[model samples]
Target: MQQLRISIPKPCTQNWADLSPAEKGRYCSSCQKEVIDFRGWTADELQDWFANSNGRVCGRLSQKQLDYFKPKEVRHEGWSFSAKVLLASSLALLTSSKVYSNTFAKSDSAIHQNTNEKGSKIKEEAKPSDSLIIIKGIITAKEDKLPLPDVSIFLKNSSVSGSTGDNGRFTLQVKATPGQKLLLEFKCLGYATKELEITPESVAQELELEMAFSDEGLTMGAVVVSYRRYPLHKRIWNFIKSPFVKHR
Candidate 1:
């Protein structure tokens, strides 16, 4: 039972009613992000949402929801929404790279590790002891372990973004400096949106984006309709008279 308290200190200035409908919630053109509607979500679902999204999350919750889910601050040190990868050997290149993540800029600034002709790793020239880090990973369905193709991944509040290929492999190149936090957002239809937070001291390591299916996307249980059982004679009589019976 993970209870979370949500407070929107800086509420969005955009009109909520004017926003267009989106898959998870509404799409706000101003922010270029989907505004999640948590009003209908259960407490469990809300807890899971906050748990997965390390630290900050932007969503709408009612006053009643606020009161019910009160004051339990969830904080995770080091890596937030971190993933483990099967290919541990490939992550060696990043081990040497001192990755300091604030926020990264658009695609132009997106940088990755350089490689030689024989696939050997090469270091990119840095500006006065700056570290250029390359983050790569594969996205897969957590349930079936199947590759999820075309899943969109991007750094929050930036135009820099990429998608998983047919093999579910994705590589993002970004230049980050020390002393700030960089938040990465992964989104796909039918699955819950996942966010990963990177810090200044944290090493650029395996960024396996394994996402789980949303509660709504999961197979629902059969609807149990409770009804009074009738005797065979009464049932037959009701069936016989059903066609003749008319509402006033």
Candidate 2:
């Protein structure tokens, strides 16, 4: 049903009428304004055209088929010749484009991973304040039957906080404040802070400060000192005063 006008060399017309039905289907002579009879074109028809033309079909041939049709002298117009060259060049570029795309994608992925690792290492090596501490314990009433795992453990007055780990465990670290009271606040999401007053003395040893779930949980326990006390500000001042300290 598709119709196209073909300008064949006048010398070609002598052999053109002998073209198979399929070839005739692709072209029609305008001289008599009559339809050239050729059967429906398909793979076999195309192959016959190539064979009968002594393997000289050019533009309609696929890239793989072009080697058979290479001419001793160019018969197609200059513009048509340029168009074929451009098409072949374009196909070659397209075939290799994936390699470049894949190379770029791999490079980008490596850079992203390296960046994440470098950022993580910087964060980990910076200071103890940003570090984490993992702890496991039961949140229980002195004489209660069931224990709760979802306790809200927080540093006093700060929004930075954590919840109990699975199996009633939790971990967090605040900036090392030597003299400042490090309050151990164990409050079930709906419960209250079983405030255990920690001085420098009692920080190291495993502790069990008994507290109630009710308001009556407030109680002052016996002092237990485990680690020697040194104020953080004093340490920083000493580091600054030392002649060995390098200035940036």
Best by TM-score: 1
Please list the residue runs of candidate 1 whose C-alpha ends up more than 4 Å from where it truly belongs after superposition.
Answer: 1-131, 200-203, 215-248
Over 1-248, each residue of candidate 1 has an lDDT whose tens digit, in order, gives 11245555555656555677677656877777777766546666765566556445456655455555545333343233233332454475465343432333332254432224224422334345455666688899786577878788998886778889989988877667775577989987557889998864564566676887564422121111122344444445566777565311
**Clashing residue pairs for model 1:** 110-173, 111-173, 111-174
lDDT of 2 by residue, 101-219 (tens): 87987889999999999999998887654323333345553533334456676767767577664455555555554455666677652234577666544455544433344322111
Residue 246 lDDT (model 2): 38
> How many residue pairs clash per model?
3, 4
The collision pairs in model 2 are 21-38, 165-169, 201-225, 201-226
lDDT per model, in order?
0.60, 0.44
